[model samples]
Target: MRKTAHRMVWDIFLVNMIIITGMPGAGKDEFVKVAKSMGFLDVHMGNTVKKYAYENNIKIDDTNIGKFASDERKKYGMDIWAKRTSKYILDEDITIVDGLRNYEELEYFKNNYDDIIVIAIFANEEQRFERIIKRNREDDIKSYNEMKSRDDRELTWGIGKVISLADYMIVNNKSLEEYKSDVKSLLKTIIDSRPKIREKLGL
Candidate 1:
C-alpha cells in the first residue's frame, strides 16, 4: 500500500505544469505569489533575463533589460528565455512558470510537458497603469506613452495571442483581497482536478 501511494504521488508530479502569461502590471506576479504559497515551484522568465543581465554587468534598467531580451531572442531563438528557465525546474511536483510572452514560449512548454495549463491575468489599461505607478519597479514605465510603447513591444512578441489562447483567464481589476481570493480558488480547482486531468490525458 505504501508503494502504491508513492507511485501515485510520483505520477501526479510528472504531469503537473502550469504556465502563466500576461502583460506587464497585469498581476502575474501576484498570481505566482499565491501559487508559491500553495507549494508550487515558481519560475519567472524575467528573473532569468535579469540574472543574465546581472551576470554580464548589463544595466538592469527598463531599456537595457528590454534590449537584452530582444537581442538574446534574435541571437539564440525566440524561445531563448523559456530554454533558460526550463533548466532551473528540477524535480518539483507542481511547477508554475511565470512570464510567458509569446507563442514560441508557450509551444516550448506544450511540447515538453504532457499536461500543461496556461493562465492569463488581465486588467484594463488604466488599471494596469495605476498598478505600475503604485508598484514603481525600476523597470516599470513612467508615462502613458511609455506604457503604450511597452505594450506594443510585448504585443509584437505575440503576448496577445498567448493571452487569448490561455486555458484560464483572470480579470484583476478589483481589490487585492478579491484577486487573491480568486487565485486561491483557481489554484484549489487546478490542484484538485490534476488527478482526473492526468487520467483523461492518459499520462
Candidate 2:
C-alpha cells in the first residue's frame, strides 16, 4: 500500500514547481505577478490560509490570520500548510507557490515532488517596511514595529534557513521596472532550461 501510494503521487505530479519565499514585504507578490504574466499558474499559501480563515468564521486580519496559521502548524506539524497547499496543484508544467514560511514546508515539497525549485526574494528591512506601508493590503503590517514582530515570528518558524537554501535568489530593492525586468529574465531562463533540469533530475 505504501509503495502504491508513493507511485500514485509520483504519477500525479509532473513538472517543476517554483516555490517563492521572502520576508513579509520582500516583493514576492510582485514576482508572482511577473510570473503569471509569463503564463505561469500560481498557488499562494497566503490565499490558502485566508481561505481557511474565511471558512472557519475567523477574522481575516494579519494578527488573526497569523495566529491561525501558527495554531494549525502547532496542531498538525510544521508542514501542515504545505500539505494543504499541495492538494491544489495538479499537472501544470510549471507552477509557482508563493508565501512559503519555513524549512519544513520546503522539505515537504522536496520529499514529495522532487522537481521543485526554491526561489527567495530579498530586500532590506527599511525597504520592506516602506513597501508594506505603501501596499496596505488587508493582511499587511501597518508599522515598523508590527513588521518587526511578524519577522520575528516567521524567523522562529525557520524561514531564514529556507531562504538561505533557495536555488535562486532575486533582490527586490531596486526600482519597479528594473526588478520586473530581472524577474522576467529569470523566468525565461528557468523555462528555457527545463530540459536540462529534467535531465539532472533523471526525469
Candidate 3:
C-alpha cells in the first residue's frame, strides 16, 4: 500500500510544468537551481543538446551551433530539441525548462499543452555578459566578438520574440533577493491557479 501510494505521488509529480527563459547569463540557471531546491524539476536544454550532439556525432560547443540549430528547425520544423526536453517533464511535479532560444519551441509546447507558461528573465546586456564570464564553464566565452556573434544568432533566430511574448517577466538586474521576490510573487499566483489549471487542462 505504501509503495502504491508512492507511485501515485510520483505520477502526480510527473506532469506539472513551466518554461524558464532568458538571454544568455540572465541568471536563468541560478533561478532554475533555486527552483529545483524548492520543488521544481529544472531541465536545461543544454543537456539535451549535449546528449543529442553526442549521439549524433555533433560537437557540443561547436561554433555556429546555435545558428545551425535554428537553421535545422527551419528545415525540420519545431521541437526537435523540445521533444527531448519534454521527456524529462514526466514524473516531476513541476518541470522548469531553461534556455528557450526560439519562438518555434514556444509555440510547439503552447499548442500542445494548454497550461504552458513562459517566464522570461532579463538583465542588461553588460550585466549578462559579465555574469557569463563569471560562470567560466567550458562554454564560457571570452572575446566580445564571440559573445556578440552568439547574441546575434539567438536574436536573429527569434529568441527575443518568445521572451517578449512570455506570460511573466522578471527583471534580474539587482541582487538575488530582488529576483527571488519576483519569483515568489509569480510562484504564489501559479500555485493558487494550480487546481483550476489542472482541472481545466486535465493535468
Best by lDDT: 2
Each model's Cα RMSD: 5.8, 4.0, 5.6
In candidate 2, residue 41 scores what lDDT? Answer: 79
Clashes of each: 0, 0, 4
Q: Residue 37 in candidate 1 has what lDDT?
A: 76
Winning model by TM-score: 2
Q: Find the 10 residues in a row with the least total lDDT in model 1.
A: 1-10
For candidate 2, the per-residue lDDT at 169 reads 98
Per-residue CA lDDT of candidate 3, range 9-42, in tens?
A: 3212324568888878888887886666556667
TM-score of each: 0.87, 0.89, 0.81
Clashing residue pairs in candidate 3 are: 13-92, 13-93, 14-91, 14-92
Which pairs clash (backbone N, Cα, C closer than 3 Å) in model 1? none
lDDT for every model? Answer: 0.82, 0.84, 0.71
Query: Considering TM-score, where higher is better, how would the candidates rank from best to worst?
Result: 2, 1, 3
